[model samples]
Structure formats: structure tokens, C-alpha cells
Target: MDRLIDAIERTQNPSVVGLDPTEALVPAQVVASFADEVRDSVDTPEEAPAAQLAVAFYEFNRTIIDAVAGIVPAVKPQIAMYEALGPAGIDVYTMTCEYAAEQGLYVLADVKRGDIGSTAAAYAHMLTGVNAGASAEAGSAGAGAHDPWHVDAVTVNPYLGTDGITPFVDAAKTADKDLFVLVRTSNPSSSELQMLDLADGSKVYEHVADLVERWGADTIGEHGYSRVGAVVGATHPQEGRALRERMPRTFFLVPGYGAQGGTAADVRGMFDANGSGAIVNSSRGIIGAWRTSGRYRKDMSADDALALVFDTAREAATAMRDDLRAVL
Candidate 1:
């Protein structure tokens, strides 16, 4: 938590770029460019397409990471974007996290994993890196205990209650990593559960917010924030503001800013008086900037397309920084 706070202060930017790449977001030419490279690398023709896209996803993530390395303090890479392609994509997701960390940026993995006691402990290994050779994607047989995920934090689901979340909290404390529990999400369907009224006179999200704060109580860092963070969507401004007051020690991983129609003003209340408690995120709005930049050409070569990706992504990231800075 202190590490992330230091980064935020150093970069003076509390906005994190979401490195979520999709087939529609990545340039076709770039995907095609890797056809020859992965054609023979795959086990069969059925595996070649996914393998090529996985490689392209890495290239896209690498380019975006290089572009925004110094401007932004962190990046949130949603695992589902890569997991959709199967095993090859999962490798790329880890590769993206490793690269972002290598470039001195915080990586927040949006995995949202939750389950009962033992199962939750197994998932906590992501932060603890305690499982040796857990996944072959992990560097080597003995490298699993050495921060194989390369992420500073991860998003978790709290539906299973304390028994489910305690492992992640303990793992975070042991590994000096952090975790954000989903509270008030930005998606349209999140309200189906998060906004439900509990018999205790509080909403579902409010109850979860209290649990999240309690879970991180013992691990508050020098920055006045705990190792456990709350994922509060930018779209729910009034509620987000109240949550900010409700959980002073809990940091925020705010999502749904740009593409989801959340403006800087909408999230201003999520921060504390010092403007240091929350970090906002923008996914397609940044990584997919090239598509909407009007500077892209279908006929452009792979190198040229990637160059555009870098330029546009950087521009968008800078703009987002300024936008958030203006309000803070």
C-alpha cells in the first residue's frame, strides 16, 4: 500500500490505465503480422490463431506499457480479456504484469476470485506466490515463491464473507502486496446485488464496505490506507462519496471513468482531503484510443500500427492525468 502511494506521489498521477486488449481493440494488421511467427509454434492449426493473438496482445500491452511507463503510476489488466483465448492468453496476462512491474509501474490484477476457506487460501497464493511450480506459466519450477504474478495488488470478491476474504488479507500482509474487494461496481448489472437493501437498514455494498475496512484494519500502512482496498465504481458518485467517509482507511480502486461515462467530477468525492486515497481507471478509453483517434489506417503496416498505438495511448493517458489533476 505504501509502495503504491509512493508511486502516486512520485508520478503525481492517481489515474491507472487499464491494459485490457480485445480482438476488436487490437489492430488486425498486428495480429496478422504474427501469423508466420506462431504458425509453426502451435501444436495444430486450431491453436495457431489464438497463439498469434496472444502474441499480439503482448505486443500491444508492451507498447502501451512503454508509452505510459513514466506518466502513470499503475495499470489494471483485467484477466478475463486474456483468459478468453485460453492458456496462451493467460501466459500473456502474466507477461503483461511482469513487464509493467519491470518498467516500475504497479500492476493491479482484476481477477475477482473468491471461495470458501481452503479454496480461498489456494487463490491467495497469487499474492503470496507460495505454490512452487503452481503453473508452468510461472517462470520456472522454483520461481513460484518469488513473485511469479508480478502484481502489486489484486481485485477480490467478498460474497463468501470473512472466511473467504481473510486468506487474501493474510497473504497481502505476508507478501507486502494488496487486494481490492469489489464493493460498488460500475457495470449496469452490478446493482442487482450490490444495491440490494439488507434487513440491517444498509445496502449490500455498504455492508461489504464495512467488512472490507474491518478486514484491513490490522494492516494499515504509513499512507493511512490499509492493504485491503475497495473497488468503487465512478458512476456511483453520491454513494462513492459516502463510502469515502464510511471507510477512511480503505483505499479505492475506482473504475468506469471514461468509456463508462464517469467524469472526473464524479470520482472527486472518492478521495480524501489530501486527494490521495483513490486511483481511477480507464480501459478502452486508453488502450483503445488509437481506434477512435482517426489516425489509424487499415492498410498501415504492423510496425506503423503499433507506433500509432503508442502515440495515441500516451496522448490519452496524459489527457486523463490532466483531467483528474484538475479536479484534485
Candidate 2:
């Protein structure tokens, strides 16, 4: 949490760009260009489309990473996008995280997995890497040196309660990483469950907020936030502000900004008074800016298309930074 705060201070930006490249989001030319390169890499012809798209997604992600290296403190690569393509896509997700870290951007993996017992323990292993022929102790001991995920933090689900989350909290402390438990999400339907009334007459998310605050109570860092953070969607301005006070030691990873219709004003209260407790994320708004830029031509080469992606992403990122700064 302190490290992430330091990064925010260094960049003077609390925004994290989401590297969620989809088939429609990526330039068609770039995906087509990888046909020859990915065909031989796949086991069968049926897998070529996924393999080629995976390669294209990596390239597309790299361009965005390069574009916003200094402008933003972090990049949240949604794993679901990569997981869609199976193993090949997963490789790109890992590679994308590695590349983002190489460029000095904190990587927050969006893997909202939550389970109990051993299953929970195994999922928590994501905080630390597991190397071949190595014991679990030895694996986490390798830390970033042998870690394949290359992420500084990850997003987890809290649907299963304490047992499911405790393992991740312990692992984050041991690995010096962080985790954001889903509290109030930005999705439209999230309200159905998250906003339900508990037996105590409190909202479901409110109770979860209490748990999230409790989870990080002991690990308060120099920045005054704990390694255990909460994911409060930017769309819920009033709720986000209340959570800020309720979870004093808990940092926030806010999503649903930009393309999701979350404005700077909408998320302003999510941050602390001094603007230090939260990092807002924008996905399609940043990475897919090129699509709506109206400057693309189907005849452009792959490199040229990526160059457009870089320029547009950088411009969009700068605008987002300035937008958030204006409010902060």
C-alpha cells in the first residue's frame, strides 16, 4: 500500500489504465498481421484465431503501456479478457503484466476469485509465484524474482466471506503485495446482491466494508492504508464517500470511470481529503480511444496502427490525469 502510494505521489496521478483488449477493441490490421506468426505456434488450425488474437492483444497492450508509463501509476489488466482465449490468452495476460512492470507501472490483475479452504489457499498463491519442482514455501520465497504473474496487486471477490479472503490477506503480507476485495462494484446488476438489506438492517456492501476495514487493521502502512483494500465502483459517489470514512485504513481501487460513465466528480469522494486513499481505473476509455478517434484507415500497416494506438492512448491518458487532477 505504501509503495502504491509512493507511485501515485511520484506520478501525481491516481489513475490506473485498464489493459482490456478485446477482438473488437484491437485493430483488425494488427490481428491479421499476426496470422503468420501465430499459425505455427498453435496446435491446430482451430486454435489459430485465439493464438493470433492473443499475440495481437499483447502488442496492443504493450503500446498502451508504453504510451502511459509516466502519466499513470498503474495498469489493471482484466484477466477475463485473456482467459477467453484459454492458455494462449493467459500467456498474454502474464506477458502483459510482465511488460507493464518492466515499464515501471504497477500491475493490478483483475482476477475476482473467491472460494473456501484449500481452493481459497490455491487461489491466494497468485500473490506469490509457484515455480516448477519447488515447494510452496520456496516458491513464495522467490518473490518477484521467480514470480510469473508480475503483478503488484490483485482484485478478489468477497462472496465467500472471511475464510476465502484470509488466505489472500496472509499471502499479500508475506509477499509484500496487495489485494482489493470487491465491495460495491460499478456494474448495473451488482446492486441486486450488494445493496440487499442484512439482518442487522445494514446493506450487504456496508457489512462487507466493515469486514474489509477489519481485514487491514493490523497491516496499516506508512501511507495510512492497509495492504487489504476495497473495490468501490466510481459510479457510487455517495457510497464511496461514506466508505472512505468507514474504512479509514483501507485503500480503494475504483472502477467504472470514463467509458463506463464514471466522471471525476463521481469518484472524487472515493479518495481521502488529501486525495491519497484511492486509485480510479478506466478500461475501454483509454485502450479503446483509438477506435473512436476517427483517424484510422483500414489500409494502415500493423505498426502504423499501433503507433496510432500509442499516440491516442497517451493523449487520452493525459486528459484523464488532468481531469482527475482538476477535481483532486
Candidate 3:
């Protein structure tokens, strides 16, 4: 958590670009580049299309990382995007985590995993490579070039309660990594359950916040924040402000900025007075700028757009950085 905060302080930008690529969002050229062998199978068989899609997603992520690595402190790759392609997709997800770290950006695997017993432990190991084993070979390998699934942190779902979340918390402590538990998510439907009032007069999310503070008690870092963080959506400014007050030492991974209808003004409350404690994320607003915005959109082939995509993405990233700096 301290390292993440330090990176944000150094950059003076509490923003992270989300690498949530999909077939619709990826450039046609990238897909075509890897689809030659699989093209025939895509029309007849099913296996090849998934394989080709995994490669395309990887190539697309590589391009996005190259474009924004110089500007942002972190990159979050949603695991589902890669999982859509099956095992090949999962392999790309691992590769993406490794590649982003190689680019000197904090990799937050948004896996949202929650379970019980060994299953939960397995999720922690596979996602963050935390508490994998104590073998001399494993220790020597380290969390680097050899560790393909290494991530600085992971987002987890907390609905299953402490039994499911503790493994991740323990693993994060052991590995010097972090965990962002889902507290107040950005989706509109989140309120359906999260906002329900308890018999004690506290909201569900507020209760969750109290639990987060307890879970993170021992893992507070040099910055006076914990390795156990919370995912507070930027879309709910009032709730965000309340969460900040409730979890004073909890780092926040604020999503829903930009494309999700969250602006800099909406997320200002997530940060502390020192302008630290949180990292805001923007996905399509940065990655798919060329396709969404009138300023960058063009009717060109994916190959033609390829030349401009990185440049457009870099410009969008820079703009987002500037926007956050203006407020923070």
C-alpha cells in the first residue's frame, strides 16, 4: 500500500488505466493478425476463434500498456475479459499481468474471487502468487520475469464473509501484496443489496466498511494505510466520502471515473487531504477513446487505426491525469 501510494505521489496522479479489452473494442487488424490460421476454423469449428481471440486480447493489451505505461502508475486488467477465451484467454491474462509489471506499472488483477477453504487459498495463489509454497526453488524464482501470474494486488468479492476473504488477506501479508475488497461497487444495481438498511440502522456497505477496518488492522503500511483496501465506486460521491471517513486507514481503489459517468468532481472525496489514499480508474474512456469520442473517431480499418490508436490512447491518458491533478 505504501509503495502504491508512493508511486501515486511521485506521479502526482491518482489514476489507473483499466485494460478491459474485448473483441468489439479490439482493433480489427490485431484480430486479423492472429486469425490467419484460425480464420478457417472460426467459420466452421469453435475452438480456433477462442484461441485467436485470446491472442488478439493480448496484442491489444500490449498496445494499451505501451501507450500509457509512461504516464500512469498502475494498470488493472479485469480477469473476465481474458477468461472469455477459455484457457488460452487465461494464459493471456497471466501474460498481461507479467507484461504490465515489466513495464514498471502496478498490476491489479480484478479477479473478484470469493470462496471458502482451500479453494479460496488456491484463488489467492493463482491470482497474486501469494503463499504458493515455501520451496527453495519457488523462493529463488521470486515475483518477477519467471512468475507469470504475479500481481501487486487483486480485487475480491466479500459476500461470502471472512472465511473467504481471510485467505487473501493472509496471502497478501505474506507476499507483501494487497487486496481490494468489493465494498461499494459502481454498477447501478449494487444499491439493490449494498444499500439495504440493517436492523441496527446501519447500511450493508457501512457494515462492510467496519469489517474492512478490522480485517486490515494489522497490515497498515508506512503511509498509515492498509494492504487490505476497499473498492469504492467513484459514481457514489456521498458514499465515497462516508467510506473515506469510516475507513480512514484503508486505501481505496475507486472505479467508475470517465466513461462510467464519474467525473473528477465525483471522486474528489475518495482522496485524503494530502491527495493520497486512493487511485481512480478509467477504462473505455482511455482504451477506447478512438471509437467513442467524436474528436478521435474515424471510419478506418483496424490496420489504419492501429497507427493512431496508441497515440489517441496516450492523449486520453494524459488528459485523465491532468483532470485528476486539477482536483487533487
Candidate 4:
């Protein structure tokens, strides 16, 4: 978490672009090349599509990563997007995570894994590069122990309470990683459960926030923020402000910043007086910039069109950075 904060402070940008690629959303040029490659391979035609599409997905992610690596402090890859393409897609996800790390960006895996303590421990190990059965001696190993697929942080689901979250907290401590527990999500239906009032007069998410604060207490970084952060949607600024007050030491992974009706002004409440403690995310808004902006014209050659796509992505990332900086 401290390392992540350092990167954020150095860049003076708290934005994290999401690398979520779908087959249908991939650029036609890239997909055509990948399909050609699949045709040349010896694998079955049916099996080849997934593998080839995975290549296209990786290409898209790599391009986006290259475009925004220097502008944003981090990139969050939603695992489900990669999972949808099957085993081959997972391979692309791994490649993207490693590539982002190599480009000097914090990679946050949005796994949202929740289960019993033991299963949660496995999830923690899988994301943080810790072996489930490693000895305490092996566990003490430094950052070098992390797996290539490991990320700097991961999002977890807290519905099961401490039983599901503690393993992640412990693993984060051991691996020097971070966890963003889902407190108030960005989806429209999140309120159906997260806003329920308890008999004690506290809301469900508030209690979860309290526990999240406690989980990262001992692991608070020099910036006075805990390794255990909260996922508070930018769409609900009032709830975000209240949660900021309640969890003063917890960093925030704010979603819904764009393409979800969450503007820069709406997310101001998630940050602190110093413009720290939160990293706003924009997924499709950034990745799909070329399609929406008309910068990549059909009249251009395929090579030139692809170049324009990268340029559009870079411009979009820059715009997002400027927007957040303005509000912060």
C-alpha cells in the first residue's frame, strides 16, 4: 500500500484505468490478424477461436497499457472479463498483469472473491503470489516471492464477514499487498443489501467499513492509510463522504467515475484535503475512446487506424487525469 501511495503521489494522479477487453469490443484489425493466426495453427477450429481471441484480448490490453502506463498510477483488470473467454482468456489476463507490472503500474485484480476462511485463504494466495502451503519461513520471503500473475492489490467481497476477509488481510500483511473490500459498490442494485439498517441503527456497509478499518489498523502505511481499502462508488457522493469520515485511515478504490453517470465533481467527496487516499477508475470510457471520438477514421489505412486508436486512448487517459486533477 505504501508503494502504491508513493506511485500515486509521484504521478499526482489517483486514476486507475481498467483493462477489460471483450471479444466483440476488440478492434477489427487486431481480431482479423488473430483469426489469421488461428487459421494457420494446427489446433481444432473450435478451440482455435478462443485461443486466437485471447491473443486479440492480450493485444488490446497491451496497447491500452502502453497508452496509459505513464499517466495513471494503476490498472484494475476485472477477472470476470478474462474468465468469460475460458482458459485462453485467463492466459491473457496473466499476460496483462505481468505486462502492466513491467510497465511500472500497480495492478489491482478485481476478483471480489468471498468464501469461508480456508477458501478465502486460497483466493488470497492466488492473487498475492503466496503459496497456500508455504511454511512460515517461506512466507517471510520478500517481494521476490510473488508470482508473475500476482497483483499489488485485489478487490474482495465481505458478505461472509471476518471469516472471508481475515485470510486476505493476513496474506496482504505477509505479502505487503493491499485489499479493497466491497463496502458500497457502483452497481444500481447494490443498495438493496448494502444499505439495510441494522437493529443497532448502523447500516450494513457501515459495519463492514468498521471491520475493514480494524483489519488494516496495524498495517497502516506512512501516509496514514490502511492496506485494507474500501470500494465506494463515485455515484453516491453523500455515502462516500460519510464513509470517508467513518474510515478516515482507509484508502478508497472509487468506481463509477465515467460511463456510469459519475463525473469528476461527483467523486470529489472520495478524496481527502490533500487530494489523496482514493484512486478513481474509468473502464470503457478510456478503452473505447477510439470508437466514440471519431479519431480513428475508416478512410485511413489499417496501420494508421491502429495508431490513431493508441493516440485516442492516450488522449482519453490524459483527459481523465486532467479532470480528476481539476476537482482534487
Q: Could you tell me every candidate's TM-score relative to the true structure?
A: 0.96, 0.96, 0.91, 0.93
Off-target runs (Cα >4 Å) in candidate 1 are 131-144
Indicate whether candidate 1 or candidate 3 has the larger lDDT.
1
What is the lDDT, from 0 to 100, of the residue 25 in candidate 1? 95
> Which candidate tops lDDT?
1
- Tens-digit per-residue lDDT, 2-37, candidate 3: 878887877777999999998878876668777676
Q: After superposition, how far is residue 142 of candidate 1 from its true place, in Å?
A: 14
lDDT of 2: 0.90
RMSD of 1: 3.0
lDDT of 4 by residue, 1-328 (tens): 7988999988889999988877656677776677677777635778887788788888888888988888989999998998988887898898899999999999999888998877786677655564335453332323335485758899999888897888888878877889999999999999999999999999999999999999889898889999899999998999998898999999999999888989999889888888988999999888888888866555565466567668888999999999999988
Q: What is candidate 2's lDDT per residue for 1-328, written digit by digit as tens?
A: 9889999999999999999889999999999999899878778899999999999999999999999999999999999999999999999999999999999999999999888845777777678776546444532233333677888888989988888888788878888899999999999999999999989999999999999999888899988899999999998999999999899999999999998789999999999889889999999998999989999899999999999999999999999999999999
Show model 3 residue runs off by greater than 4 Å: 37-44, 127-146, 293-303
Q: List the residue pairs that clash in candidate 3.
A: none
Worst 10 residues of 4 by lDDT: 135-144
Native-to-model Cα distance after best TM-score fit, residue 60 in candidate 3, in Å: 1.0
Clashes of each: 0, 0, 0, 0
Candidate 1: Cα lDDT at 97: 97
TM-score of 3: 0.91
Cα RMSD (angstroms) for every candidate in the order listed? 3.0, 1.7, 3.3, 2.4
Cα lDDT tens digits, model 1, 1-328, are: 9999999999999999999899999999999999999999988999999999999999999999999999999999999999999999999999999999999999999999998977887777778775554364322112244666788888999899998898888888878889999999999999999999999899999999999999999999998999999999999999999999999999999999999999999999999999999999999999999999999999999999999999999999999999999999
Ranking by TM-score: 2, 1, 4, 3
Candidate 3, residue 236: lDDT: 100
